[model samples]
Target: MGSAKWIACVSLVCLLGVLSRGAAAENDFGDFSLSRSEWSSEYMSLDSGHFLDRKLLQVQPSSQTQLLAVRGDRRDPLDNFRKYRGGYDVTNKHYWASVVYTGIYGFAIGVAWLLLGALITLGACFKLCCCRRPKVAERRSRAYYWIPRILAFLLSLFAIGVIITMFVRNSQLHDRAFKVRDSIAASANDATSTVRNVSNTLSNVDTTVSKYNIEGLNSSTLSSTVRNLNQQADSIDNTVDNNVNTINKLINGIEITLIVLLSIALFLVVMGLLSALMGWRTIYFLIILLGWLIAALTWILFGIFFAANNVTSDTCQAFSEYLATPSNTTLDELLPCVDLATAASASNVVRQGVNNIVAQAERSLTQIEQTSAALGRPVTLPTVCDPIGPAPAFEYNSNCPNGTVTLGGLPGVVAPFVCAAEPVTQACLGAGQFVSRTNDTQIRDLSSAGQSLVTIIPTVTRLTNCSIVYNTFEDIVNNQCPPTKRALRNIWIPLLLLSIALTLLSLDWIFANHRNKKERYASGRDPEAYNNVPK
Candidate 1:
């Protein structure tokens, strides 16, 4: 009995080991089953399912009697029973693991979102309290006069958008992670159960179990298949490591972008508040205008980041698929081609051939990588592709003076080369010109230091009268003209508050007028008093 206990314990230990490996494998694919639907997608969409199936799917069976064949493949009656039991156990474990991870990730994202919401709410309260003391009419004027309230509102909106985006992304990552975990656990359990039951049945009859086993192979085939599968898994592991390393670089870039954007936004908010409180209208408006201008400028940074992300993701996915089989042509062909010359001597032909293929692959990979980095990375502004009428005809370059804009060259022709972003220039040399070229309506009536903004676009007539054009350059390095300078105008909140204080001086003027008029009218009753009325 003691000997029997020892054997059973060893068997159980081995069984657990097999289950663990199986579980991990399933997790890699999330909970997504390799059903007919999945197989079809892998076949048509990926165009590389055969490679994955032969390399990774054909690993050695974990124990005697265990098999890894097509789901419905006909097998000996006893083998079928063992496979079914093993598959079920694996499925169960993976599902449980997935649930746990999903819950944890969800909680973290929820907490972050809640915190951001609370901060916004707190900011709003402060805003209301600050203005509560003034009369209703005065408060109304203060609100419209544009100061802390507008700045706060805009900042809050930006924060909200950011928070929402983060929540969505976090949720997606958590979901995918949990799915992989669950599938791995379940697959392990299933594989283990099948082996255990089969081993037990064979032992009951004192039948010796085979040392090596393959799902659909005889003894000789079993050993070779097992070796190949092991090699394939190892290769895939290496590839995964490479992909992760690249992703880390992208993650670092994203962190920097987020930090810069947040700092700029926070500083703007503080400055706007201070200006409004100080009663300096000119200064306040100037600051507010600056904030809007910065926000608009951020749109370009966002676009570049997005482009980078797309490239990286595609490259990573392709790499992941390649790793599942080292012998596969997809990865093998592309891994070695960095610097060999294609037009070299015959002695160098072998090196050149490999390098040529690798070089081609590297170029494709680089483009994808750059795109991915840009996408996964965060930016200060979200890209807004809305057609804000026609683009500006103004010529913009990095060399353009900071605050003074110039539209050089002839009127009816295309605007000079102006890129929204420096690195990626628009293709057509004279692609699109600014819509306000005709000067039918003066965009800016510039005379001396003062300038008034007028809209040339008839569709946006509302801005024609009130919008004041100030001396400011394009939103970005490129001449992607933003909504007329009103959006760019920095109505520094702090400055706006100062202006309100100055507007109060107008009240003093009204009071002085009243007193003078009263004295003059009273003096009219007596000529002597009328002469005494202060000038």
Candidate 2:
């Protein structure tokens, strides 16, 4: 005992003397930047399935042009518009509160148990020579020693409860989700009705939006006009309907994945409990301890990812906000008519054809007006539904060669329209044409030839409704984007606390095992007596 006491005094003096020397410089110089200003850039993307600027499809042309102007127009901002056409984005709802608390408790238990195990094990082994055991020691260990194990179990249960609670809370949101979905469907239906209303209204306007009703024309221009109008309306309808279907699919996929994940987790939990209950507690401890390390590493990695994507998170939030507005404000201004613009401007030939047709229609309207100049007098035209120069002529189709034919084979001039299907002779072409109509219909309208242009505004307006909902694959991206906020507060700090928990729990478990083994003799006899007597 005297020798042990002397050794302890000398060790304490040496430790104090070493610490007093202020410890060798732990860090080399230049480890940190001594700067007043710092600039950083992150390559985080808004869509996990893509990288960088490629996912921004519905870019505001105005904004892009603005950027171009800022850069002195050296770059074409339109070049940046790239569409994302991928499968459903996977989602993660970060359950921070529950995750952090559970981890904190585990870490603390590990630390406490490790300490307890080390101290008690050393004392029992008589390694601390001065601390001699009593000859008549208590036969059993104190109930207080089991507190850490009990607390660990209790805390584990609490974490499970928290997870269950989150599921419950989100289940309510699912109810809300159904309502929101129905509302969006209603909105789409209303927009469809509005387009039909515009069509019916335009039919009443004279020479402005209706057909000229020229007689016996092989290709019925009026029917074609109505067909085009209906086609535009249908595109709006189809785009929204497709978007809704995709969203539904996404939800179904998420539900399935979540179910699979939870089932696996439950299986792990059950196996762990079964092991412990069956007295293979050491194995159970190892399972839980190793499981905790893996889980901690996973969470810490995820937390780092969330922290790194600060800009992407903000952009996702901005996208959400952009979609929420119902007005024709900047949101409307920015995105409205863009689909039509993209479809229309996709080819220079198509634009030129559209221009020529518009010019011819104007000329026809003027000539007809001059011939019928008598006030309130109606004049029958010498010819109705005249060719109008076939501005939107097909450059390619059944009989026409792709890229070699344009504007119905204008030869020298650029053909404005191009057809991807059979020629207009055998097929009407495009969507309205695609909807199934005869190439040569005798049906004609009594309205002016130029009147068909009125469908543009209504078509554009209806199309904007598609953008108001889940228009693309980014819906899930926005939903799942990780926020940089609260990671340190909700994740890392709690993880640190969890490390503390783990340390404590390890000590308790280790010490308790020794206590059980040390007292496993007749009437708490010392080791020497137990070795010699009644055996």
Candidate 3:
């Protein structure tokens, strides 16, 4: 019994190996054959019965093959030329059949790819959302260890999606080629039938004219009859010529259309073939999706970390102390926040407040000095106008000479003046005015840009992560995923659900096998039934 079990396992392993090797071989050759550009290259199985007769017919010669001998300006070269025509080319028909066969092969590959993609996607979803082992299982693997596997699986899915898309595109081209071939064939048949009918009608007319003794009638009447006959013959000749020209035009159109279609199809196949040569896994699509999910998770974690570390009250206290103390003045030096103008034009409420505080302190000090001066009554102090009334407030300007200052004028005072060692030039004054206006606008513009960037950055980052979702190609390749998606939430969701169901089914099958084994051991005395059971 142990030996038989071992043999069964070995056989299963061998079968799997064979299947894998077979698929690899097919893929390698299929790509090469599809990519080849030889004129004789064909996709149909030549060994098959259906193609044998077609091959024979293609090689055989027909009466219309001689029409090429008398080729002229396609003018009225021969009267009966149209009545016995054949197809223009045999090679074109064969090329089309090859295209059809190639398409069938590609379609088969696509079906396999779709199944593989679903399997891989399901595996990834299971790794993400489900436990490695069942909840009731005794042993469990750590989730972190499985992360790499999940990423690898997803990447494999992505590559697979690309391969499938390529295969589908190739198949579509092949189908177009087949359609063109069929159209050409149908047109040829129509032309042939029309020509045969005309030939038969003409032959009958010749026989009737011969049978009748019209030349033995009255001289005048005979001459009239002959003239009418001559006119009718000319008309018949013209009609036959017109019909033949129309058939030739139809043939030319079909050939041109087929050639164009075949050329495009050939290009697509070649491109797909070259792309597949690189050693790449087909399941890399799932990896891309997994990558996005990882990014989203990373952001969620980062946001949590940032929130947890924030100390609002402490931050406020630190900010206030930092502003007040000169000991810790690095931030002040770095930022260099002067009392920036807040109003429209040159008004700055903040600068005015600072000036008020400074002026009040100075006046008190000055009064104390004057009191001492009065109490001492020493040498008479020269009366001096106070130079400490209000420190001049300057409006911010981009083009102002360094250290140029502006006085905050009262309502009646003649506007404001720029103060410098040298009187301000007209050019300088104009520059300063332009600078002030631009500075004000720039500050506002910078603030707006900053706010916009802050708002949009996180959203843009999230959208970048969401882009992986669009990398999906199940529907695009064969439209298999749409039905699956509509039937469920998405392709992955159904695949995940199905995987769980299959796992359960597999386990049930295993358990049933165990149960049957126990039953057979209990009744091993009946050796025939036990043997049959194993088989």
The candidate maximizing TM-score is 2
Error of 2 at 208 (Å): 15
**TM-scores for every predicted model:** 0.24, 0.37, 0.17
Model 1: worst 10 consecutive residues (lDDT sum): 466-475
Please identify which of the two predictions, 1 or 2, would achieve the higher TM-score against the true structure: 2
Candidate 1 lDDT, 282-325, residue by residue in tens: 55444544444444334333333332222222223333333333
Writing each residue's lDDT as its tens digit, candidate 3 over 196-242 gives: 33223323322322222211111232233234323433443443344
RMSD of each: 35.9, 24.9, 43.5
- For model 3, the superposed segments whose C-alpha errors exceed 4 Å read 1-144, 167-171, 203-210, 213-535
Task: Give the CA lDDT, 0 to 100, for residue 281 in model 3.
Answer: 26
Q: Give each model's clash number.
A: 65, 42, 20
The regions of model 1 sitting more than 4 angstroms off are: 1-230, 248-256, 277-297, 304-535
Instruction: Give one digit per residue, the lDDT tens place, for model 2 in 1-535.
Output: 2111110001100000000001111111111111111111121111212211222443435433211001111222233422222111111112122222224334454454445545655675685487554544333334533444455455445444433543443344334334434544565565556555544433333232122222211123223333444565576577556656654654455345434533443344444444433434556556555444434433443343233233223334433543443222222221233242222222221222233333333343344345334323343322222222232331211233333312222211111122234443333332222211111110111112222322233232223224323342133224333322232234334434333443333344443333333323334566565333221
In candidate 3, position 446 carries an lDDT of 22
Candidate 2: worst-modelled 10 consecutive residues by lDDT: 12-21
